[model samples]
Target: MPETGSGRRTLPTVADTEAFGRELAADLRPGDLVILDGPLGAGKTALTRGIAAGLGVQGRVSSPTFIIARQHRAGDHPGAIPMVHVDAYRLGGDLDELDALDLDTDLNHAVVVVEWGLGVVEHLTDRHLRIQLHREPESDVRTIVWEWIS
Candidate 1:
């Protein structure tokens, strides 16, 4: 089993982070909400990129910081679903401005990955997977904690 942030397990490299993401992706479904919390350069986008790959989404998976969000459609697989990636870093204060963007309407059909998502977007759904990334001080390592709440 993978360790949470409170545990001693550490992520030594970028590939480990991506691999952990792929493992987590196996449990995802449409309408699933993922909230990612981390500081700058903590590999939030890297994990999302791994998720996109796991979901069979082709093309590049880049940060949507400037554009707010980006959608990636699954290819080849008939039952594949879509993914909605959102960046909440730019939305200061409350998420009213972010909510005004009408992302709730798209929540039904795609897997939503919200970066810098903490208190702002947690109320969007009662059920969600919250991932917290922490950087280690002694080394270039990271610790990711995934919590499934319903």
Candidate 2:
């Protein structure tokens, strides 16, 4: 919460992964872009659930793989931050496809979380939080590394 910069953390359970997300979410704000890089069955979605929870967005938070992107409005709640969850796994060679979502329009008013968005969404912003999650062999635990670029 004190702008700790970049570091790594190990989560032993699904809940732990989400909790870690909540912890990381403490410093998030509108226009924040979080790129989650990891393999299938990794804790990418789980961590995003925690982030959405911390943002005070309503409704169930799930992977938007099929739909590609899901917008969670902050509603009438004062101080609530809106969220845009995107799945870049299905994107092709051109990330310019992201242009169709019009993310730039509300970027200053929403938190954008993209799964498998490494090389795909870097052009969105120069400042962002990059989180990479990796699963341990035969273990439910996951190792998450984070970097905050300004």
Candidate 3:
């Protein structure tokens, strides 16, 4: 298993952001929880898309804003893990609503990723990867800072 660490990156394009996510996924496991904090247009969904690709999960990864969550099954690769992508913006900090989704249960079988989940999802796990994305003013560039918190 990879040790806990933190780092920052400047992504020049959407592809760069996704590539970074793919790299991050290399250290993830089935029970990992990843919280993404960012404003609108920060490429959170794109990063999740990359993570899905890296994990070899089946499905076209997309924002779960409307549905709140989406589960992607593992692919054919040995030891492949599934992914549960979530958009928590609509939850409005309601823990009950969050709990209704039973994400903690999914964590045991999939990598649970929550967007807009800084304060809301941390309690679901003892340790988690927190990633903050910042989009430059009036530009497509993005800066991402992340760390594994325990």
Candidate with best TM-score:
3
Backbone clashes for every candidate come to 0, 0, 0
For model 3, the local distance difference test gives: 0.92
The lDDT values for all models are 0.79, 0.86, 0.92
lDDT of 2 by residue, 39-94 (tens): 99889999999998888888899999899999998856677789999998888645
Off-target runs (Cα >4 Å) in candidate 2 are 2-4, 75-78
Q: What are the per-residue Cα lDDT tens digits for candidate 1 across 1-150? A: 322222224689888888777766776778888899999888899889878877777679899999988999886887566788999888864567887867677788888999998877877876888888887765658888777767
Q: Candidate 2 local accuracy as lDDT? A: 0.86
What residue runs in model 3 are displaced by over 4 Å at the alpha carbon?
none
Off by over 4 Å in 1: 1-9
Q: Which TM-score value belongs to model 1?
A: 0.88
Model 3 clash pairs are none
lDDT of 1: 0.79
Give the total clashing residue pairs for model 2: 0
Give the winner by TM-score: 1 or 3: 3
Compute the lDDT of residue 59 as modeled in candidate 1.
77
TM-score of each: 0.88, 0.93, 0.96
